[model samples]
Target: MSEKTILVWFRNDLRIHDNEILLEAARKADKILPVYCFDPYYFKIAADGTPKTGALRARFLLESVADLRKNLQALGGELIIRIGNPAEVLPQLAEQYTVNEVYHHREVAYEETAISEEVETALWNLRLNLKHFIGHTLYHKEDLPFPIKDIPDSFAIFKKKVERDSNVRPCIGTPESIITPVITDAGELPTLTQLGLDEPVDDPRTRIKFKGGETEGLLRLEEYFANNNQIAPTKGRNGATVDRSSKLSPWLALGCISMRQVYWAVVKHEQANNVHNTGMLELELLWRDYFRFMFKKHGKQYFAADEQTENTSAEKQTLFEKWKTGNTGIPFIDASMHKLNATGYISNFSRQMVAGYLVRDLEVDWKKGAAYFEEKLIDYSPASNWGNWAFVAGLGHDPRDNKYFNLAKQASELDTNSEFISTWLPVEVAV
Candidate 1:
């Protein structure tokens, strides 16, 4: 009898906890091999000629992957690393290990899906199977109230329907131990310099210094829900003001912690504390889910630029440079841009404000802003980042006729003390 060896290809879903592919591989195969490919394509420059991944994000990813390797080693398994195209590397690794099947989490974004298709084609030629698991979203695709095509265009409608009709499944238990065949030469993790990015300098004013991996991700989750650290939003006349509460996004974006894990934690905390303050947190998770599903439904339309948008790209690029470099002369926009450049992150309110300023005020293309966010954000997920940008640009299923933000009005209202502005803006540039 032949051994059923399965190769678990780690992509965004990098953790050992509540991982469907890892667990299924453990059950179905005699020995499972875990692998993460540092696909060089992701490191390449985008159409805008800026890096597809900037230094800060590259650093965070490297940390996350390293943590994953360490966790796997502790579990008595080794993470095989390779710096090449997954489409080519996976097939090569499968043949070398005599793997019968390749298991991975499916992605919904355009380039990701294209890569998956390429890998699928490569695997088929070798007569090996590439099984894709849908585990990234809080609400699983199977559990959705409607099919992907039929999902409500308005997020409010989608959220209301899903909450009424669907249920979030309980998180699967983490494996006690992983059994693996001897891997003599699991490759080395790459450094930031090797990935064509310089080392990131730490900033003292960073709201949160994010570290990657399942261990760190779980610890942050515990700390977030701890009695002393229960996060509550600052209320304004409109509603809860924007803050990057909890700071779990980078981990969540990299799949160090699954959405279901976060969702259930919120549920337990609310139940135990007899408080309902976690609704906004849960809504964030749902918004992430909505974006993923929307990408599945709309394909590249979320990213597409109309003819007029393309023709205006030259003019937009000039203004975009000013906005990108924090030279916009608008105190609020400049401050937020400076923070983003320094720390790969900004508050949701800041993001909306800056994005609205760029698209509506400067009349730059929203796609440019989204592309730069892709390069800079440590927590950048294709669905959420692009979808939110599209929403701000009034291109997505935002039911609002006006997604514009009056930057001056918002700054006056939200930053009444101007402390946030003062902190981020340099003294030389301070208004």
Candidate 2:
């Protein structure tokens, strides 16, 4: 019998390390063909009237795809690139390449899940197997202590149960070399214009300068923790430079590196250096895992808003425009929005505050704010992003008092020297 050919569809899990789908495919197939699609659906204008995949993220994605191709090539394989719907392009590739099987890391978010479902059905119709693996979360779904539906709605409960019950799986091995598959063009990485995005302009004030891909992500992990001795602070929620940031989320967002790889890296650091504060960072990862499970448990309901939240800011368009532009007249919320627009990211505290401002202060629907962030954040994850917004909107995992911060108090503490605010403030705000 001739050698079996397998097609590995690259989605969020872009890295070669601890990649269950990639490793499993390498073990079975004679030739492994890796492919990534710059899906048009993701780039289209969002409900908030901005491209869901904006320039910063589009550029980061482009960089990541380029890096992924380079990494795969270094391992003696080529990453086939495509532009279009995965549901269509992936199946066409399976037919064109005579693929015996298709393997991919599964996604839990509704839109992502829907796309994967369609691709699975399409591949099945072609008489090829579409295999899905769990790589997005820290813990594999099968290994979870409880069924996804039975996952506790409250994060505190879920976190305690998981920490006691589950183990963080070790990184999987990468194949040194794989048999070559005959595919036509490797396909060019599309330019920003091709994706209907402008070239991203550099901004000096932004906290995140993260490049995409596993190499950069791992390098960042080391530099942030080991070199800088930068453990995550107790999230002071005061937007000081160090108080507010770590650029890890962007890499995690892209699946450029798996949560397991990141978790292990921290473990190695703590063991080598005898650090204790790494616990908080590890907890953050657990929360990332919790959101994924939440997405799995609730599906579309996770994105819904509670009916009680209202639009206090007159018209929907008027209030949203101010919120989006960071002209909300609340200096703290405005500053956070300004940083987000300029840098494509904000610290977790800022995310909570701004999201709360939109819901509680402006009385705008939390979904509107969530939709806006989805279009903008360099590290946007549907589960975490929507889950967080809903949590603030009193619609997610916890049913606590709706979170709201004193804008003046936060501004006073976060920008005491007037340095951050004055530096990044727009001309209008500054004047």
- Model 2 TM-score on a 0 to 1 scale: 0.91
Cα-based RMSD of candidate 2: 3.7
Candidate 2 lDDT over residue span 1-431, tens digit each: 98888999998888888888888888999889899998999989754467888898888888898998988888888999999999899888887888899998888888998998899888888888888788888888887899988998777777788889988888999888756587678899999999999887766665457788888987887777754436655433354544524468999998988888888887887788786667767877987998899888888877554656555455877988888887766776777787788778887878887887788877788888888898789899988888888887777657473322233344455643323444354333332
TM-score of each: 0.92, 0.91
Count clashing pairs, candidate 1: 0
Best candidate according to lDDT:
1
- Candidate 2: regions farther than 4 A off: 46-48, 232-241, 303-305, 308-314, 401-412, 416-431
Candidate 2 colliding pairs: 310-363, 311-363
Q: Write the per-residue lDDT of candidate 1 for residues 277-359, one digit (tens) a residue.
A: 87768878988998899899989875454444353566777888889988887877787888898889886768888898898
Model 1: per-residue Cα lDDT at residue 371: 89
Looking at model 2, residue 203 earns an lDDT score of 68
Model 1 accuracy (lDDT, Cα):
0.84
